[model samples]
Structures are given as structure tokens and as C-alpha cells.
Target: MYGVNTYADTNFASITLDNDVFVGKDNGYTNGLYFSLYNVGVGLRPNFWVSPLLWTMPRGYAENRINVHSIGQTLTTAEDITQANPPEGSLPYSGLLKYTNTHIVVGSRFTDWVSTSVGIVGPAAKGKQTQTEFHALIGAEKPMGWDTQLKNEFVFGFSRGRAIRVLASRSDTMDLLAGGQLSVGTISSGVNAAIMLRLGQNLRDSYPTVSLASSRASNPIAVNNSWFVYAGVSANYVFNQIFTDGNTFRDSRSIDYDHNYNTFMTGITYTIGRDSSLSFAYLSSFSDDDTEYSRQTERLNRFGTLTLVWEF
Candidate 1:
């Protein structure tokens, strides 16, 4: 007999020519458009204390932007590029880039201690490349001692083609994420926090090779493989009834730093009404080194989001 939803504030920013990341001198406009949606359908049953629930969230965005510069050039074909030898000489180049992603999930809870979910991630399209993913998860919350709640969850997935291959092709690709969280004190009244950790692996295929002799062999260059670990903590607060709490702060966003890696995010949310809310968050990417490959570097890009909700 209830429903909820939200949308965050839109943002626009200019890319300064003095930005340190660019090789030479460059200038352009960079912007991002993001949105999210969630819906839940409940069915009452005579024998159950809680109704059977079906929930789904479809969220994604498209970024239409460009970077014009005098520092980079385009390779006409894949043959012109090499893993060991990248393009040299400063040549000006510019083009349009676009990307989009969607996720459909379903699940139900038995009693209040256990729940399960399974979902298929549609293909994520970027320019001429596309990728797909699938995932399954199960979690439980059990009372431990007098005031603590023990929470645990496990998830697994399989991906193929350019989607999984793209990240695997990177020198710092880490695949697979596994972790759990634990909390103490009441969850509805807020004032609780939990820590989590995740580990990843990079599965890179071998490059083409040729045999020089009966016992000697030569192999062509390929991308590098790597392993990574991530850790973080989060908490929430409520000033009204748990479900109808509009003055509560919460975190409800996912963060992924391309190429099989995880991110740690810390943020707060404030609900303005039954159909309105606002949130501000800071996320940091954790990696093993500052330099991964020659073409990319590990630099922290900070983000702040203000969200508003409307329900029907």
C-alpha cells in the first residue's frame, strides 16, 4: 500500500584548458546526465505476516561531450596500433563518444532474516563496442548476542565477448567481487555503520605467437593482468518513522571505475518529503599503483550529487 522514488540534481561544468591531465594544450565542454527509477509491487497472502514483494530498479545515463586538442591523433585501423609502441608526435584530433547501460532485477524475502535475487544486465554500449553481464546473490541478517546484527552476502557472475574482454585487455584489470557487512544496534532508528571489502582478478588471454624453431617460440604483445582489493564503510540516520522517514540520510548509488575495479564511497541523504530527497556523496577509487598503463593514470575524480524524488 505504499511506493517511493527519486531523481538527483542535474550538473554542468566546463573543462579548463589548464587541467593537468592533458598532454599538451586543450579545451572543450564536459557534462553528465544521470537518473534512476525504482518500483515495487506487493501481493497479500492469507498465511504470511509480510506480503510477497516484487521490486526492480532501472537506472542509467548518456553523456554527449567532446574534448578537442592538439595533443592526440587517431589510428586509422587496429593494425596501426601496438601494445608496446603507441602513437608518437602531437597531432590534433576530435570525435563524438556515447555510452549507456541498463539493469533488470527481481527478488523476494522469506520472513525477515533471508532474501535472494537474480538479475541479467543488458548490453552496455559505448561507441562501436558492447558488453553484457549476469549476476545472482543471497544474503541474511541474524541476531547475534543482545544488540548486534550479523549480516552476510555472496554474489557471482559471468561475462563474455568485448564486455568482459575489454577490462581483461587492460594492464590493471581485476575481475570478481566478494564481500560482506556486519552491524550493531537498531537499524530503523539509524546510527549504525558497517565495513566491507572486495577482491578482484584479471583474466587475460594469450596473444598470437609464432615458432622460430623446434624448441624456440616468439609471442606478440598483449595487455597486462592485475589483482585489486577495496574497502569502505557506510551508515544512515532517520528522524521519523522508518519507512516514511523523510529527514533521513542514506546512500543508494553504485560506483565502478572501469576495467574490473571497485570504489569506496561515503555519503549522506536527506529526504524532503514522501516523494522528494537530496544526497551528497564522495567516492574514491582504490588501486595498487598510480601508473597502470602508458595511456591512463589513477587520478581521483570527485563527485557530488543532489537528488529529488516524486511518487505517484
Candidate 2:
């Protein structure tokens, strides 16, 4: 939610005996699950109050659970990453960079088209502290394109306290967002964006952030039962991803220079059963500006992910 951008920092990290590498607060993995808790966490309301109508129009909560895995290269310097071949001390020049993340989310559908959710997220095994996130969302599936089969959805939400390590309080934002999604035959795609309007001691007014993801579940194969495979790509463009990282390597987030250039993602998912599925993906960021001049950039190396899901 809040730290989805590079400027938004989290205090999470991990290292294993087998592969002693640093996996920062987040592995740079982004999720793209259809039944994702975020699909309706803050449910489309620009306002925070719950609608009294929802109480009378809805039944009881319909619960479900899911887990997501993310993997990618470690965060390295812009120089090292850009080099064709890094020197010896820069050992990770190749694939030594690996990051894994796991997320467990619990969601409930309050109405046929509305849901609310909360979740605990952490490293797959090592680094940083844990984080919690919650949200409410609402959407309607209707034809968005000329093709009647291309059902589209308009969704909106609000999320807060996503990083247990930072702003655990509701003081700053993690506030609002809205977007559009489409389901067409064997494919689905979405684009969502947000802007931080409310200013705080730890935050700066930022430009609107945007992200896009898409998947296709077309390859079919039958083993124990019918199964299908899908692949997708996603990208996030954020301004000032880390707003307050006053450090030696970097300091002070500014719109003129410091901002998240972009993070790119690609992955595959498989439906093994009616209620179970699996997915794997990779990520890389390009914010590598190491200059004091305005309009410069900085970047993070690479990372990846794996996700397991089950729903009812």
C-alpha cells in the first residue's frame, strides 16, 4: 500500500546460511492475483466511513486465504548492475542476487461485489521485521469493451499501516486509490494509480503513482483434473519511492530528482485445482540516480517471487 513505491521504505531484511545475501525490507516483488485481498480492501470509497447500506444489503463474511512468494536479484549499485562484467569484490555480478518473499492474507467478501481484508507480510525466512495491511474495496463486472465477453471492473480502495516497522500509526497516508480491470476470455489485466494529497512530517507531496499487470490462462492440460497455465507482466512507476531515507548512499526524497523510475515484473501461474493454484515471478527496479543535480536517478538490482493460493 504505502511503501509500494521505492520512496516508501520498510524495515524488513533477511539472510540465510545457505545463501548469505541481503534481502532488503521488501524483495521488490508485486502481486497480481485476481482474488487478491487488495482487489477490495478499501472498496472504492474516497470517503473512509462504511456505508450503512452495506449492512442491510449484504450477508455474512465469505472468507478465503492466500499466500504469495516473490523472488528477484539483490539490490546492487547502479554502476555494478550496469557493468557488463563486475569485478571480483563485486561477486554478485551474476546470479548471487536472490530475494524471496512470502505473504499471507485473509479476506472476506461482504457482498457479491465488495470485500474487506487484512494481512501479515514478511520475508520468506530472514531479514527485517513483519508488517500488516488492511483495506476495503468494491467493484462491478460489466462489459467495458465493444466485445461483450470483455467484462471490465471499476474498483477503488484505501489502505493504511502496511508497514508494521514504519508509521504503524494512522498519522500519515496509505490512504486512497482507484483503477480499472478487465477479464477477457482467457486473459485479465488491470491498471491502478494513486496520489498522496495529505502532507505529513515524514512525507512529501508526490505525483500520481501508476502500475499495470496482465495475465493469460490459456494453456490447458489435464493430469489429475483439468488445469490451465497463464503468464503475465507488470510495471510500477512511482515518484519518490523512499521519501525519507536520509543516508550516506541516499538522502532526502525530492520530486526534482529522487523518485522510483520503474519496477518491471514477469511471471507465470498455474491452476492445479478448482480452489488451489501456484505462481512464480521476478522483479527489477531502475531508480539508480547517484547525483546531486536535479532530475537524476538511482536503481535497485533484481528480485523474484512465488505464490500459493486457496479459496472458497
Candidate 3:
């Protein structure tokens, strides 16, 4: 049976920041910030609303369970934000503020996760103010299209996934992990799979996969002696995406949602001490031909992720 402290290494608080600035571009998933708490049940009770979701999944004898809670905001913008009304078929300005709770079960070589979220979309998410003020501070052009951003609406999401360590070096200095995830909800519906290779010290203490979305749970490393570099590739087939599909229950600026995407990510992680670590990764995404929506599909989507985690 799993012990109460089976996941003590993951009892942490983290903040993640993502932006295109690191890649020298400034549109399409432009910015995001998130704060998260992991292994909440270790020191505090899980949120009451997340209890029912946990009840649905029975625990296994060899697995230990934990709760993760996260809150975040993300912004997406048209290619040209200087225009009060972006060109026809261009990506629309959109914002999301969401809170998510995840149930995780960890075994010796495999981990499973289920998550749900609720969020507000459109002007209520403060996309306009945040971007405009940020641009001014950076001496960049003020964005001018928030007036046409997605309308106010509530969105919900659910996701499930699992990761497995497919191979490991006899010396425990390297490992390979394969993972797949499915998501369904008003925010987006998609399936994605990825494989990652990690090489460095204390590979066993590192998180298995890199998240496709920066606003979601990301790579978390435990312990002060761990350091590694990892690279991975993932393919996604998105059936629906609110940022492109627009408002779920109302008429709003919309575009033909891109259906396919391939992404590559590489990064390095270093633990600063028993309680803290830093991670930085670069991601580049490519999509197959879709509608001529401002020609966005032909361009590469690039961004950088920076994360800081501290264990209690």
C-alpha cells in the first residue's frame, strides 16, 4: 500500500509565466500567468467542490493520490492588434480566467490524472486592460481591438491523461516517458500524445511530460539534487477551441478552428535548493493548412515558459 508521505516531494506551490516575447513575436497565445498548489491534501484539505470529483475515482492499492489546484489567466490576440477591427478571418482577441482542480494518482512507473475547470471568457477576463497597460510599460504599441473580443460567457473543461516511463537507464541517469491526454469541454476538445527523453542527474525525481498549454500543470522537479534537460514532441487534433470558435452561447467574432498541430519543446531544469527549482523551456508549434484566416496557419507559433516551484 502507498504511504501517507508517498508524494511528499510534490507538496509545493508554483507560479508559471509564459509569453511570446522570448521568441521575438507578440501574438497568438500572447501571454499567460498561473499559480498552483500541488499535493494539497498533505497539509490542508482539498477544496470542497473538488471532493465529488475525487469520489468518482477509486484509489488503487499501489497508488497514492493527491490534489492540485490552479488559477490562471491567458490572452490571445489578432496578428495585428493595432487595428480597432482586425482584418476579416483574422484571429480574434480573447481572454480567459479560470480555476482548475486535478486528481492525481501516482504509482511506481505510471501516473494518472483527471482535471476539471471553470472560467470566464471575454471582456470580463480583463484581456484588454492587461495587454494595453503591459504594452505601454514596454513601449510597445497599444492594442486596439479588445472591443471586438469574444463576448462574456462561462466555460467549462474536463481532461484525463496518463504517463508511463517506457525506458530507463540501468544507472537511473536517463529515462523516456510516453503520455497521452484527452480533453472535452466548452473551452476546447482535443487529444494529444507525446514522448519525452530526460538525461541528467536524478531523473527519477523529475516530472514526466511537458504540458502543451502553459496555463495547465507544467513540469515540476522535486529535491535539491536534481537537474536535467528534456525534449519532446507532441501532436494534437483539436475538434473545437473557444479562442477560435468564439463565444460558446452567443454570436461573436469567430474563425475556422485549426484542426491539427505539431509541437516541439526543449528545456533545462535545475534545483536551487531543497525547497526551490527553476525551469525554462521553448516551444514551437506548426499547423497544417487550414482556412486562410489571416494566414495564421502558415506561421510558426513560438513561445517560452518559465516556472518557479517551492516545496513546503
Give the per-residue lDDT of model 2 (tens digit) for 184-247.
1111112223221122222211111112121110111111122222222223342222211111
Instruction: Return the clash pairs for model 3, or none.
Output: none
Highest TM-score among the candidates is held by which one?
A: 3
Ranking by TM-score: 3, 2, 1
Task: Between candidates 1 and 2, name the one with more favorable lDDT.
Answer: 2
Give the TM-score of each candidate. Answer: 0.28, 0.29, 0.89
Q: What are the lDDT figures for the candidates, one per model? A: 0.20, 0.23, 0.73
Question: Could you arrange the candidates by lDDT from highest to lowest?
Answer: 3, 2, 1
Off by over 4 Å in 2: 1-237, 242-260, 287-301
The better candidate by TM-score, 2 or 3, is: 3
Candidate 3 segments whose C-alpha is farther than 4 A from its true place:
1-10, 40-58, 61-63, 208-217, 220-222, 288-301
TM-score of 1: 0.28
Model 2 residue 263 CA deviation in Å: 3.0
Error of 2 at 66 (Å): 13
Evaluated at residue 260, the lDDT of candidate 2 is 36
